[model samples]
Target: MKNYFWNMLINIKNGQMAKKSVIIGPRKNICESFLKILWNEGFISGYKISPQNTRNLEIFLAYTKNGKPVINSLKFLSKPSQRIYYSSKQIWKIDSSKTFIIFSTNLGLKSITECKKNKIGGEPLIVIN
Candidate 1:
């Protein structure tokens, strides 16, 4: 099956490029968790379930004062065919200060920092810088 979270990422990217204030996507637990991560990391202003249609998600894009998108780059680590999973020990090898990696764990999606702090790891989903 296609990854809806990846499509949501693309929508956010496209929305930023097009200077769109908001991007709409299907409401999904995973996607909502990812959006929450983005918001916590300051990539997006925020997101909410659409009032008109509860099944839709409305994500507010964030931009800089000079009209530049907050999210400048994105890297997808896991694909449907080949998945990437990292243990807490292996996750400690990545030393990136400018980027954050999202990992899907049993408790839901967690960032690299959270994984490291909690001594847990999961599939490396995407890296945003």
Candidate 2:
């Protein structure tokens, strides 16, 4: 999951969006949620479940008018062996305008803003800048 997200961000930043879409593999529920967040945040143009392969998902990366990638950076805050959990009270803004933090809660994967709005929290997953 770590390398997949990191590589996707880097590829998009390195002009892979020119291809219009990128295919990501072998299926994971969390990837779907992350892609949904990217879409909602306008970091991606669009995405869809792959019809050719149920295990694969297609992502449409976004670019600026001058053709620069929309995502600047992605950081994984919690490791499998060293997880970081946060309560709603512990959640704070991490560059609300340019960055977003994803968390895995009992309610499922949610962003910091969403968790704060809903008054719920969980393990912090990744931060994207």
Candidate 3:
């Protein structure tokens, strides 16, 4: 099956600031880490964890002053069938600091910059720009 979290994120980005937030179904550690990274980087305004019969995560989307969604595109770099791993040195060599790169490093789900800072390597998760 396709990744539910990635699908949700892509759909939200395609909607172009149409909704303030979305409620996603219960997710594992990887998905949670991805959301946390997005919030910390300001790609998303905020998120709240709500648990009832099932765990649901509410995420507030970010938008520009022109009333446009902040995210232009969101793509997964790694998948269950095909994976991409990178080293800290390779990450530092990346020229574009503006593009957000999520890395599943030893320290947990971290951005490329964070991976570089910690001097670690990991599987590249996704890129959002």
Against the true structure, what is each candidate's TM-score?
0.94, 0.78, 0.81
Q: List candidate 1 segments past 4 Å from native.
A: none
Deviation of model 3 at 87, angstroms: 1.3
Mark the regions of model 3 whose C-alpha exceeds 4 Å error after superposition. 1-4, 14-20, 25-27, 51-54
Q: Candidate order by lDDT, highest to lowest?
A: 1, 3, 2
lDDT of 3 by residue, 35-99 (tens): 78888888877767765534666667788898777787877889888988888788888764678
| TM-score of model 1 (CA atoms) | 0.94
Candidate 2 to truth, TM = 0.78
Residue 121 accuracy (lDDT) in model 2? 75
Model 2 ranges with Cα > 4 A deviation: 1-21, 93-95
Residue 18 error, candidate 3, Å: 4.7
Per-residue CA lDDT of candidate 1, range 79-119, in tens?
Answer: 77799889899999898586789998988899999999998
Query: lDDT for every model?
Result: 0.88, 0.72, 0.74
Worst 10 residues of 2 by lDDT: 17-26
What's the ranking of the predictions by TM-score, best on top?
A: 1, 3, 2
Taking the tens digit of each residue's C-alpha lDDT, what string does model 2 give over 1-129? 566655554555554535455645435676777778889988788887788887777777877788766776667788778888887777854455556888888888888888888989798877877
Per-prediction count of colliding residue pairs?
A: 0, 0, 0
